[model samples]
Target: MKSRYILAALLATATVMPVASFAQQSAPAPAAANPASQIPAADKQAIQNFNLTDDVFNRIVKVSQEAKAQGIKPKDAKTDFSKIHSLDDLAKQVTDSDPRIAPLIKKYGFTPREFLLANLAVTNAAIASEAKGNPRMAAYVDQSKVNQKNVAFYEAHKGQINALMNEEPDPAAK
Candidate 1:
């Protein structure tokens, strides 16, 4: 039960925190220097295969709400949030902003990195689900790349996910 709240917070923060930075972080110098490294290959596949489950998703939402209620806000990050390029980098940004988040998420069985991935997976699945029913939206999503499991989960919990995603942050919680 406590873990569920932590998980929810992790998911919410993971989605909101990383998104801006995910797009802007610099490319790995190591990858550039070692183009053939298995590390990069493994990281790529890990991101592609990060799985999401109902328990994990519930925890993320719970964590997010709990964090908000506690007023456990993240500080300003070091990097331009707009420039974060990878999940690792985004996790770093999130942790750096709020050291407390590490322990918070740990209670829910997530490393910050795992939270970010789960958050992204949920967001992607939501988008893909929406695209499935609307031809105009479907035109934008690549069906082959969408994870069927995630979509199925989203379909099953559309109302809850949408409510969480559309919720406005409480001003007093800031």
Candidate 2:
């Protein structure tokens, strides 16, 4: 069986994990189930390339809330998606602990340490911005932006990062 299929089966058996954004969040496998009894080819590639699971998406949703609390106006973020790295990292920043995130550590094959560093770097940018008027805050802000940018660089290449997840390298890449 393919890795994607294998991951889907395990998630379907687990039940709590649902593919929320891709399909209506109801139950497991509904996302994969027949809207047409066949998935469109573009969507198939998109789902695989998206490199994120529904559970992860749900967790990432919290980042918007976090952004609000940090005083980053929607316009501020929208004009510069660079502020959040990419759509995926934008979602990843505010994630709290979810039980489903555990099995996904293996299945998704994410580099947790790297991801956490990236997540925190972005969060700290907001934190640093608050300090800009204060000299102490300025120092921290400079440091935070540096951290955020460093992590963002990695995040900026999410397509490449995603290429590594829940998938095997194509023979041609070799």
Candidate 3:
């Protein structure tokens, strides 16, 4: 029973793992030599353009964390959340593949891509917020600013974003 909750949390958080990986890789560069700047304008724009709300964002974070904790092994129960770096590690804790996530996605009436976009928006905001005080993370802070701008753009264009998300065909349906 506990495993089930952890599996769900991990699955929820998995959506942001890719972005987190990108941030980690680029976070160490000198602020002036930031690698995130090399990201194509179109790609950056796309991320900025995605929309999500604080209510949904908080829910995802809470649910994912709860789920991840539930899934932690008794031996590994002391593991820090930051130590679980990869999505695969989280996935492994639950089993071969997560069967629980699809239902949650369905419950939210979100296609996988929509869910991912929502996660990306929230994660970008989170990364930006975390980078605020640390000098070593200046590059990420810059990137986070861009991401926050994109989130704002998303909010401004929510109707169109929703239309596009709704139009996207669910991968499972195909």
Q: How many Å off is the CA of 83 in candidate 3? A: 23
After the best TM-score superposition of candidate 1, give how far the Cα of residue 48 lies from its true spot, in angstroms.
3.1
Tens-digit lDDT track for model 2 on 73-126?
212112222333223343343222233343444344444332332333333333
Candidate 3 structure quality by residue, lDDT tens digits, 1-174: 223233223334543443433454623554234423443444445555665665555455444443343332223333234433332333343332355554554455654445554655655654554455566665534463345664454455556433432332233432
Backbone clash pairs for candidate 3 read: 5-67, 6-67, 6-71, 9-67, 48-150
lDDT of 1 by residue, 61-83 (tens): 77777676666654422344354
Candidate 3: global Cα-lDDT? Answer: 0.45
- True lDDT of residue 113, candidate 3: 48
* Whole-model lDDT per candidate: 0.60, 0.32, 0.45
Q: Which candidate is the best by TM-score?
A: 1
Task: Tell me, by lDDT, which candidate is best.
Answer: 1
Error of 2 at 157 (Å): 16
Better of 1 and 3 by lDDT: 1
Q: Runs in model 3 with CA error above 4 Å?
A: 1-44, 58-96, 143-145, 149-174
